[model samples]
Target: MTDAATRLATLAEEALGAPLPLRIRAWDRSETGPPGTPVLILRNRRALRRMLWKPGELGLARAWVAGDLEIEGDLYEALDQLAGLLWERDDEPAAGRPARLVTAWKAARDPRVRHAVRDLVALAGPGLPPAPPREEAGSTRGPLHTLRRDKQAISHHYDVGNDFYELVLGPSMVYSCAYWDRPDAALEDAQHAKLDLVCRKLALEPGQRLLDVGCGWGSMVLHAARAYGVRAVGITLSEEQASYARKRIADAGLTEKVEIRVQDYREIDDGPYDAISSIGMAEHVGSVRYAEYTGILHRLLAPGGRLLNHQIARRPEPDEEAYHVDEFIDRYVFPDGELAPVGRTVSQLEEAGFEVRDVEAIREHYALTLRRWVANLERSWPEAVRLTSPGRARVWRLYMAACALSFERNRIGVNQILAVRTPEGGASGLPLRTRDWRG
Candidate 1:
């Protein structure tokens, strides 16, 4: 190996306690690590210089997105290995202050270390290339939960082209956590089951009216209208979603039974609906506005009417700050999105005068759902790339995979909370036995 390759290898060993599972090939054709392993090719010196300049996951992600670094072979495995190395490093006990100072003094005095540091500094100096434009980045304007800003955030994510979403989400077009009755069930079947599950939990009657807040692609609205014989009204902030959902309702011949509106929940004055369903949209409602959201749902539903809220929640961790994965998501994916704990969600519902009936944790089901989405995206990679930029595709791939891992590890949770608006001195209107809804 050349001196540069050798130095990198040594740095890897020192930092990660072992050489990387993949081989690293520098710009000069200098190679290190095992030949048969997966290859991580650095296109130019800027790649290494970027790593030294920012020195963490962000730097690596920037390099990969900017086309300075390329990974050959399994992309998932490469990310897994990278995460494992970071986990191991964090698990190591920290040295005392004096010991760290002594080590730093020794490193600063080493002639080879000095020279290497100077070379990296010069490479990453003012002449470094500017960061590529993040066309997919979300908006950072206005207050968190205002009607205007919420629309902007929702549009930033869901308006990325219906064709692109179709490529990733499959035919069912369900964007929420699916209910997989069996391990080998198909994606469409699982999504159907999830929609039926929500309808069942709400116990819709033949002529009752149902409102679906933040409905994506009108899946729930169509399902309720077709299967449960209910008049459904679905609302969303994305004009693209509203347009596509209307066309779908028209094609399904449910235009009279189902309605899609590009309206905000806060502005809805027509209410007294028999039932309401809010799925996968509460995360965008900041914790500060969670009470207001639940209050709105409570007011919209008729007395004794059921409200089913399905949302993703963050699991309680000892070091709360350490479990924050929203930094990357807020920048590249869902801007201003916040997840509250399940307990907090329940409390908000109760505070809004809704009696909480049931809270079902479907964490593993979301893991399965995300895994299927990643598989679908991989299968349609060519179409996906044609519809969107390569960097945008990579963002979805990495974000979805990481979320699946997070769900599998119990770092986060998805829950369906069943609540009811109870009249004064009245019962909850739910059946005494849970088996009544199972059928």
Candidate 2:
């Protein structure tokens, strides 16, 4: 009889109609495929059962999260090899050749596929459906983007422990994209540069009031207060963030200059802030509430005040309506989060009564940032697993690595859109000369 790894490889190639890219190491200590390749560790039959039950990206994600599927070599290479099989870049329905999705859907009717599934069932053995790991979030509990639901969504992602975050995010504790002078800049320095870049774009002046929406751990508020002499209000839904930020503020003796609130952006009553920064936050706003989110910030800012909106955007789909959230991201990393095209983001800001000034696409910066983050997590792997769970650590590692690849390939991008609420004279506060935001 053939070993499990050989059987697995044969079965997978036959069912998917493609070669298995990664080397296979089965539970029986049997291995197959060439040397020096990434070995995919399939710990047990349950891993196969996961694939059989869900039969797509979610299935793979489940097995990975459950510590059943693991890679023993270069993770990026493994992901790169699997990308074409998993994430199809083409949005058009027309596939000149039969796509994996079409092939899977026709599996029942096709005799070859039916035989493959029967073999897969025998290989997977008998088992009830495995429960998802405790780290995974359930499906959206309430109406999307409601005040309560938003809080829950925010908490799900952000409440994963400040210690763990500090390890992953480093001393900066800034979760957004960093402005890298070069590809190899220090993480802290790059993060500082990014904060300063935002302040310059907003033209922060002495005693100006700034509002930072979705501020993570008060990095922006503290930086602005210390460096630019701005009084700032930073708000987030995560209590852990608020607590961590408040302590940082007090320690820095900037308590008087900055306020950290565990409050939703919608609940902010006092407004007319001189400037606003919503970095890496609007993706959580959901497309349905995007207009409202932009309107809120526009209303909150005084006339001639600048708004720096930093967000991640996906490639525009041909049908637009054909776009959907990645199942792994929605379920594991960012619950109920959504991304829009950069053009759509600019249009919505313009519609909300803001004159969009500059749109900078710093796609490569994010790829670098994510790689640094992955390095941080991998460096502190044991501590990270101790602080969070092994499952959560794995989630971070996979998502960050995958996202880094996404950024590098331009499958998605991060943009900084600087807009302003122009007064009646239509005079924007920006200088006559062009200011380079990327430094």
Candidate 3:
């Protein structure tokens, strides 16, 4: 029989193109390997003992975090390969009948945090719609500063290396837009369709000035400027993202038409933009200040100007399990983010003095988008592991899995709302579509 060392060597030779560079140390009695093809497996003494005694995925992940399991070379790819051969790929699993019924019951009530009682209510009682928003007490604090800080929460995941993101995100790196209407569309096509859809909804015209709030790496801004011939200004709180966006704009020779600002939306004094787009940013506005947040956009737009508030929202009425799972995302992924249902969103816009013209739900589309992202991330895990620590990799893995689950289960949704600000009490007669335009 081959010894453990020889077996590992043989496995390494077959799996990886190069020989393994294994290092064993008494510091925690850990073994680690360098980056390369296949996986560079690392095992600590504790993990080794555990594997010998009993084996489980939880044990494996824990060992990896404990510095027991290490991998080198394309961590994302390694993970992907392992997932194809190992982990269950189901989007959502079917619980037993009783458990499913219980979960179904819990998901029927819209509550702060669904308790067992709520589940009973969902199972036994009539469904209640989501509670309405209260009057704005308004804050004495600066909303712009709050906006910037809120942006940080949204951009946190974006800092997880563009390469890792690229593995999961579509080729266009358009983080916000994905067309869910077409089930068979490619990521690039879906994203482009989303962008075009937004442009159409906003009624983008050549020479129209556009503002993108919480613009991620300037994807929307760049696309609008180039495709629609609009002068675009994008604001983001992420310094790294702002720098990257600026470089991208420069590279595309769009410096003349596109401006990337590393500042908070509230701090922006220059506006009266022809249109506004805030994709995936409204969730961070907090339910408390929804009116004010939208009001600010309305005030900044030109008369008869339109605004697209693209965000994740909950259903007007939701069950207990959905509430529980959504709260989990708030604590782990979004931190300060809160999602209001579409009814509340529209009502808030109306309260802010804007007329809601349309509402679109891309929930199913986002579910598909997230699944693709997961597949991409899995495929790139090997590279991801090599570039990042096990803890980081696990965090992303868990986050992606949770997000995918959230979309699949309808605990969350994305809304693209087109709202128009009436001109001076509905007096202006601006043409909806202009034929004569200057580029």
- Single out the weakest 10-residue window by summed lDDT for candidate 3: 130-139
What does candidate 1 score on TM?
A: 0.87
Candidate 2 local lDDT, 1-439, one digit each (tens): 3489999888777766767767999988899977788998989989988878886678888999999999899999888666655554543345332245324535567777778778878988988989998889977765799999989888999999999999999999999999998987899999999999999999998899999999999999999999989999999999999999999999999989999988888889899999999999999999989999999999999999999999999988888888789989999999999999999999999999999999989999999999999999999899999999999999999999999998998889999999999998988867776475421
lDDT of prediction 1? 0.80
TM-score of 2: 0.96
lDDT of each structure? 0.80, 0.89, 0.63
Angstrom error of the Cα, residue 435, model 2: value is 2.5
Candidate 2: what lDDT? Answer: 0.89
- Overall local distance difference test of candidate 3: 0.63
- Where in model 1 is the C-alpha error above 4 Å? 1-5, 16-22, 34-38, 84-126, 136-139, 317-325, 435-439
Worst 10 residues of 2 by lDDT: 90-99
**Candidate 2 residue-pair clash tally:** 0
Estimate TM-scores for all models.
0.87, 0.96, 0.65
lDDT of 3 by residue, 1-439 (tens): 2133344333333332344433222223333344344453534335444322222233344445445556555544454333322222222345211112222223436342234333323322243332211111122344432655565565655565666666667567776648855777788888888888888788788899999998887889988999989999998777777888898899999999999988776678897999999998787778657777887898899888889899888755435234322322343346566777788888999888888777888787887777677677677778877765555565556556555556666757888888888786674333454222111
Q: Report the C-alpha displacement of residue 249, candidate 1, in angstroms.
A: 0.3
